[model samples]
Target chain A: MNIEIRKASEKEVPFLVRTIIDAEKSGTSILPYEKIFGLSEDETENILNSILKQNEEDCELSMDAFLVAFHDNKPIGAVSAWIEALNDVSSSVIKGNLLRQHLSMKNLINASKYWQNLQEVHFDIPVKSIQIGLVYVAEEARGNRLAEKLIKQQLEVLQKKINQKEEKVFVQVYHNNLSAIKAYNRIGFEIIETKENLDKNLLGVLPDTKKVLMQLINIKNE
Target chain B: MNKTEVISQLTPIFQIVFNNPEIQISENLTANDVKGWNSLTHMILMSNIEESFKIKFSLREINKMQNVGDLISLIESKK
Candidate 1:
C-alpha cells in the first residue's frame, strides 16, 4: 500500500466527522456526542461539520488539527492532535466554547440538565502539552501500525509549532479500550493518570466513565 | 434591563459558576481574569445565564462574546 499522511482540508469534513464520532465511541454503539447533547447521529454530524469547518487550530475540532492516513490514495485512518495552549487559552475552553456556540438551544439545554454525568468523565489536559484528542482506523487496516504512523506523523507536524523545552505528549482513552492502550504502549506511552466515575448512572449515558491519560515517554526525534 | 442591572445580575451568576465570589464583573474581564473559568465552567455559566435571563442565545451571539461587556451587550440585545 502506498501510505501517505497529511493535514486534512475543509472538504474532508464528512470523513473527519465520522472519524471523530467513531473515536469517541471507541468501537461501541454509544456515542458520547449524541448522549451528551441528547442529539441524534445526524444532528451531531451537522453541528460537528460546522465546528470543523474552521481553519484555525482550535484543538481537536479544527479541520487543520487532524492528520489523515491514506492507503494507496484512499483515506483509511486518521488522528487529531494539537498543542494545549493555543493563543494562551486552554484547550478545554476552546473546545467547550465552540460546542456551546454551535449546539442547538434544545441540545444545550439537554446537556445542562444532565451535566453531572458528563462532568464525571471530564478532565483537563496539561497546559502547553501535546494533546491527542481522537483516533480511528478502518477495520481492514487493523494490526498494521497505521495508528502509530498517524500519531507519529501528527507529533512531527506539531513538533515544529512547539517552542517549549521538554514537551509532554498526552492522550486520553477509556480504560476499557485495551487494544488502543496496548497500541499506545507499543509507541512508548504509559498511563500517568486515571479518572473513574463513582456514579453508576453515568454508565447509561456512556459505555464507560473510567478514562486513562497516557503520556509519551520515549518519543524520539528522527 | 439596563447594563447596570445586567451587570448586577451577572455578578452573582459568574460568582456561583466560577466559585469566585471576589470576581468583579468588569467590561474587560475575560476567562483569563478568572482562575476556574475553563470549558466546563464556561458551559455551566452559559446555561445559568440563559436560565436567569430567560433567553436562548444564538450561535452567532455566543461566538461574538469576547469579554464581559460583550456578554452584557448580547444579553441586552436578547432582552
Candidate 2:
C-alpha cells in the first residue's frame, strides 16, 4: 500500500476527526476542534467553523502542525506537533492552572501537567523538537510499523524546519500505554520523568489516567 | 550473540511473558502471530529482555521489532 504523510488539508478535518474519535480509547473521547484539541463536540465545531472562515488571513501563526498518514488517499493515522514559535509566544499559564486544579486525580492530572509543562519548555527555548501527540494507527495496520513511519516523517519535517538551529526531536507517551512506551523507547526516546502521583498533579477530572512523560534529548548526528 | 544462544536466552523471556510452556518461539514468530501478545504482555517481554540482557532499549527500537529475528538483530547491533 502506498502511504504518504503530509500536511493535512482543511477538507480532511472531518475524516481525520472521525478517525481520531473512532480510535479513541474507552477512557477518553476525542472531541474535534481547531488543531485537534480534545474538547466538547460543541466547542470543536465552533472552532472548525472559525478556522474555515478565516482561511485568507495569510496568518503565519505557528500553532501545532497536524499531519495525517494517507494510504491510497484514505486517512489511517495522524501525529501532531507544536510550532516552537507559537510555543514561545503562547501563554501556557491558563492550561497549567487548569492542570493544577485537577491534581487530585494523580494520573490524568499529572499527564496533563507534564504535557503542558513540556510544551512550555519546548516553546520557551529554541528547541528544535516536536511534541508527538495523538499518534494512532488503524488496528489492522498495527504491526506494519506505520507508527514508526509517521515518527520518521515527523522528525524529517522538524529537521527541515529548524535546519539552522537544528538539534533534536522528541515526543511524549502515556504511562499506562506500555505498548506505545515500548515503541517510543525502541525509537530512541528515553523516560526523562515518570509522574507517579497523578492525582495531585493536574486538574482532577478522573483518578485513573496515568501516563509517563518521555523525551529524545538527542539524536545521532549522522 | 549466536542465534542459538539468543533463542536460548529468549526462551525464558517468552515463558515468563506469555506464561505458556507450549510456546515454541522461532525466528519468524511475532507478537501478532501469538495469541496473547497484547500491549501489556509486550511490556513484560521488553522488561524481561532488559533484565536478562542488562541493556536498555530505546522506544524506537522497541516499536520496530516485529519478531524474534528482529529482536536478535537489535541485540546484536547494541552489543
Candidate 3:
C-alpha cells in the first residue's frame, strides 16, 4: 500500500475528530471527550471543527497539530503533536467565547478542573520539548507501524522548528495500555515516571489505573 | 490441559481478542505478528486467556512472556 503522511488541512476537521473519537472508544470509556466536554458527539465534532478552522485561518498557536496517514488516498491513521507550550494556547482556545457558546458553564468548569488536575498529575514537561497526544491508527491498519511513522514524522517537523536545546519528546500512556507503552518503548521512549493511584474522582475517573509518562530523549537527529 | 490442547483453545482467544478471525498462531508469534495486538488489546487478551483457561498469571509472568510459545508454556505449567 502507498502510505503517505501529511499535516491535516482544515477541510479534514470532521474526519480528524471522528478518527480521534473512534480511537478513544477502543480504549477506556471513562474520561472520554464526550463525557469531559459534556457534549454530544455531534457537538464535540462541531467544536473541534471550529478549533481547527479558526487555527487554519489565524495560523497562531500550534492549532495545526494534527498529522494524517493516508493509504491509497484514504485516511487510515492520525497523530496529534505540538510544542508543550501550545497546551496553554489550545486550552485558551477551548475556553474561548466560541466553545463557551456551545458548552454549558458546568461542563466548562468540569473540563477546566479535569485538565488542571491532569497537569498536576502528569508533572511538567521539559522546556523546548514536544508532546505527542491522541495517537490512533484505524482498526484495519494496525500492526503496520503507522503509529511509529506518524510519530517520527511529527518529531521531524517539530525538531526543525524548535531550537537545538529542545531535544526531548514525551507521551503519556495509561499504565494498562501495555501495547502502546511497548510500542513507545520500541520507538526509543523510556518510562521516566508513573503517577500511581490517580484520584479516580478528580481526573482519570478510572479506578485502579495509573498514567505513565514516557519520553524519548535526544530525538533531534533521529 | 496439555500443551497441544492449550494451544488449540488459546488460538481462538487470540482471534477474538484481536478481532481478527483469520489470525493464525504459532509458537514464535509475538505481538508484532498480529494486527491490533496493541498494549490495550494485550491486556484484554490476557484477561480473556485467564478467563478461558481458568488460571491467573502473575505480573511477573505476564511481563516475562515474549511469545505465544511462552504463554502456552506458562499455561501448561499453571495447569
Candidate lDDT (C-alpha), each: 0.79, 0.52, 0.65
lDDT of 2 by residue, B1-79 (tens): 7777777888877875566788887877755456545432454466557768888776445545546787888877766
Put down candidate 3 lDDT per residue, B4-78, tens digits, no spaces.
Answer: 899899988877665568888888876544544443345456656777889976644554555788888999999
Q: Candidate 1 on A1-222: residue-level lDDT in tens?
A: 678888898767888998988998887888977887888899889888888885545568878889998888777898999897655555665677788876666876676655655555565666678888899888888778898999998887777888654788999899889999998898889998888876766775665778888999996433
Model 3 lDDT at residue A19: 63
Model 2 C-alpha lDDT per residue in residues A11-78, reported as the tens digit of each score? 66665544434433412442212112334555544444433333321111112355778888887776
Q: Is candidate 2 or candidate 3 better by lDDT?
A: 3
Per-candidate DockQ values are 0.33, 0.01, 0.01
- TM-scores, chain B, all models: 0.94, 0.90, 0.94
How far off is each candidate at the interface, as Cα RMSD in Å?
A: 4.1, 17.1, 18.0
Give stretches of model 1 more than 4 Å off.
Answer: A220-222, B1-8, B15-41, B50-79
Q: List RMSD in Å for every model shown.
A: 3.6, 19.8, 20.4
Q: Spell out the clash pairs found in candidate 3.
A: A178-B39, A179-B38, A179-B39
Could you say which candidate leads in DockQ?
Answer: 1
Residue A144's lDDT in candidate 1: 83
